[model samples]
Target: MIRLEGITKSFAGKEGAVAALDGIDLTIARGEIFGIIGSSGAGKSTLVRLINLLERPDGGEVFVGGERVTDARGQRLRALRRSIGMVFQHFNLLSARTVAGNVAYPLELTGAYGRNEIAVRVAALLDRVGLSEHARKYPRQLSGGQKQRVGIARALACEPAVLLCDEATSALDPQTTGAVLDLLRQINRDLGVTVALITHEMDVIRRACDRVAVLDRGRVVEEGPVTRVFLHPRHAATLRLVREAEPDGGSLDAAAASDLGGRAVRLTFTGPAAHKPILGRIARENLVDYAILAGRVGHIRETPYAQFIVSLSGRDVAGAIAGLRASGVDVELQGVAPVPEIEERACHVV
Candidate 1:
């Protein structure tokens, strides 16, 4: 339930104005986890701030929950902001306050409750975030994940219809990251809150987002369903985002660069096609030899899927290729032999 039309924001640089966001057109549906992914200076953070009018756009419109937010001022803006909650990379909690106290702070700001009312709401929030046991704990005593849980609880205190997470898991370890992501997913499902998250981590987007917008150089290069974007990324930046999502313990640039002498096609299998080992069966029945240079089998939405780049060898090259294609399998001839030159060319083009 968010729409941004021709939204542009700029800041004065030493030489001239630098466009942080340039004519951005975005629409996020209600109760959907929408993601904005980009590297540093991609205007990801600025775009998120524009949603809440934390950074008003210089040109174009900002609409949140069907209300215009670009030119909202004073009481109107303050009232509109109450329906949106934001979390940051650092768990921006009041270190001086206890876990329960921090969650109650938002309610206090709105002047909406007495002490007992605040306590009841805070207790419920602590329970919702699984921090009831640590209600009295101070920020310094909690781990990064717990601190984030506190931040999330605080954000939920206002019962905002939208939650804007700005690199919410960037500071935590992988285990903690998964926990926080799970918590956010639950928050979305249970509370029906629309979540908009901006992060450099593709894994975060992959796990949390239903749809995503790939931002590069302050422009949206691509935006669509998470599974579509992950399986068939259209842009270099989009592919980069997918690579970072899994990574296989290293950068995708190097992994993709590894020479696969034959044509390397990124075979994306989905739906019923993904569940079966069709490729393996074809190789076995046809008596063909194939070398799997680099590949992975993973799930998107718990559906079994895989991608592999294999070097095929056999006498009936065209026939064998046709056989796989005829069986409703997706295939592409990447290239042949002379691996290094082809890989170099691909890298440069991307």
Candidate 2:
């Protein structure tokens, strides 16, 4: 329930004004977990802050639930902010305040609830985050995961409709990161809160977000459903991020060369058509040797897709490729590898 239209933010630099967000146009549907991903200096954090008016845009409009949020002053701004809760990577909790106290602080600021109501809300929120036992502990008394749970409880104290997470799990260990992500997913599902997370971790996006926008150098290079984007990333930056999570040596060109070696074709399969056992049937029917060089299995939108590199050795490599194409496989033959002669190593013919 948030939209940013042509939002641009620039700051004075030594040479000139440097744009942090360049004409960012994006929309977050109600009750959807949206992810914004980019490398360092890509303005991801800046863009998120603009959504809550923590950083005012230099140009364009910021709308929350279709209501304009820019240029708001005093009470208007404060009220708008209360509707949006933010969590950070650092787990910004006060060392002096106990977990319960920290959560109650936000409700106190709203000043619309009595002491008992605030106490009830705080206890419920703490229990929701699975930190009911740690209610009396200060920030220093808890672990990183516990501290983040406190931050999450504090964020939910106001019952915000939109939650902004800026690298929320970056500072935690992998196991704890997963735990936090699960909590976020539960928050979205149970509370129906619209979540917008800015993170560099694809695993986080894959596990949590329903849609994603890939930002590069203050501009969104790609945006779409999480599964679609993961399966067929159109941008180089997007591909880079995906590849980082599952590393494969060499570039795409190098991979093509090593796999094909000017011998066989490269095939691309997407959607439901990719699920067929094409390779198995081809190998079984053809009396030729097929050597698989490199391949990987990955999930996009929680669906399995495989990318493979293989070599075909026989007198009729072209025939095998043609047969595959005829069967509705996307095949591309690069060149040909020199046919190797089979020589008798020893006297097998006794």
Candidate 3:
């Protein structure tokens, strides 16, 4: 329910104007968890802030639910912002206020509800975020996850249609991150809140996002369904992020490459193909053998995917690759390894 059209933003720097975001065109569907990912300084944080007009764009339009809000000011801007909730990486809770008071602050600022109504709303929000038991506790009295829950509850006080998360789980431990992600998913499914989250962690995107946009140097390099982008990353920026996220499936080093005696290829299998013994069947049919240099079989969101880097030999390498392609497997020929006797190792032998 959010759209950015050719959005550009720049800032004053030592080197004159430095562009933080350049020509960003993005659409996040209603009730979907959309993720924006990039390394530090990639303008991901700036892009997220632009959605709520926290950072005004230098050029282009911002639309929410089909309304152009690029130049919204005064009450209009305030109203637009009220309809959008934001949660920060560091839980921005008021230390002086209790949990219930923190959540009630937004409702108080809106001046739309009476004291009784604000109290009811605060109680409901606290319950929704599973913080009812800590309603009277101050920020210092709560754990990191609990503080984040308070932030989430406060954000929802206005009953916003869209939720903007700026690395909301980055500070939490892995277990806490998973729990927070699960809560976000539930909020999307049950409350029908449209979520746009920006993070550097691919694991967060894989766990919580339906679609993702990859940013690099203020430009969007890749954007697609999480399954497609994660399984078969095409852009160099995307590939780098994927490798960092799945280090075990990284490319072979020079020493490892020297051991394999033929063509090196990477195969990506998805859907039903991922479940099949296609590699074995292709090898038996084409009279070829392969040594798996690196491989991983896992799910990207709900879709099962298998990726393998293998050294192919025993003549018929081209035929085997063609067979894999015909069977809907994506194959990338990495290059031919040096010709010699293949090393007998404990790697995946097929």
Candidate 4:
């Protein structure tokens, strides 16, 4: 487990001190895959570095497994680092080293094992990462994904209790990214190693993170379970990230709104509500004619969710909205239509 309390870090900038992290307070539970997401220059990378003391915080404390390691030095710092493993965006493998040799490098540096022990440990690690067949091969001979597998194997050489992944899948193609994500998930489940990954990709967070923190301009603007944050992004930064992740969906057009003759509303449904026949029931009971402007149904982790941009024409628009809300559907009135006013709610969904 890792905890950062009131963490703040800054560096010299052309305009003076620039804060890479400001007043950050985060707790990553043991064995959980926690994600830190932000755009370029959003301080995601700097925050991750602070965790391993690669960039010590200008203020506040860093705690791992309940130990305050903010000021640890020498052997203490080295020992703390050995319990944490890091993988980079670029597969940081020694090009001259064979796959086995890359994995053995860390163990050799520790000087805690003899030749036979290091060889056995390296072989087991190669096998664990499914790179046993490539053990004799060099980095240049492997594909991008394979090279990353080598990087992962090397990181695990120390058998660290925590894994820090810095944009681990950012460079690969979509298919390869999925493969690497799957491998990380398997590692977490099998090894019970706590994972803290930083990326600009919302898809990566959706697929791998149990909880997430959205960073913007050196501040944590939002943080929550992936399902809650993804399905109903509260911050503008979070919404922008979500839109970038799924840009295929069209927004409700003004012409479409004018033709519907009533109210345009966005509905969000999650879990069992996503599969229920609530829409049909609402239409039958309220006699409302509904037009689907745009929508999507997908999974947030394992939970099924559906979001719809609907145009509704009916005598009881308020009743319909209330009905949907009563059935656990999140209903937001699109500004394009003139509808009865209701109490404002979180997510702008009444």
For model 2, how does the per-residue alpha-carbon lDDT over 80-150 read when each residue is reduced to its tens digit? Answer: 88989999899888888999999999999888999999989999999999999988988998999999889
Over 200-261, each residue of candidate 3 has an lDDT whose tens digit, in order, gives 99889988999999999999999999988887777888877876664343445534544766
Q: Over 4 Å off in model 3, which ranges?
A: 247-249, 254-259, 336-350
Sort the predicted structures by TM-score, highest score first.
4, 3, 1, 2
Residues 259-333 of candidate 4 have per-residue lDDT tens digits of 657678878889999899898799778888787666777776678888877778877778888899999999987
Clash totals in order: 3, 5, 0, 0
**Which predicted model would earn the best TM-score?**
4
Q: Provide the lDDT at 282 for model 1.
A: 79
333 Cα displacement, candidate 1 (Å): 3.3
Q: Report the C-alpha displacement of residue 310, candidate 2, in angstroms.
A: 3.7
Candidate 2 Cα lDDT to native: 0.79
The runs of at least 3 residues in candidate 4 whose Cα sits more than 4 Å from the true structure, single-residue gaps closed, are 248-251, 336-350
What RMSD, rounded to one decimal, does every model reach? 4.7, 7.1, 4.1, 4.8
User: How do the residues 16-112 of candidate 1 rate in per-residue lDDT, one tens digit apiece?
Assistant: 9999999999999999999999998999999998888889889999888788778899999988788899988998889899998899998999997
Native-referenced Cα lDDT, model 3: 0.86
lDDT agreement with native, every candidate = 0.80, 0.79, 0.86, 0.86
Please provide TM-scores, in order, for all candidate models, with all chains considered together: 0.88, 0.84, 0.90, 0.91
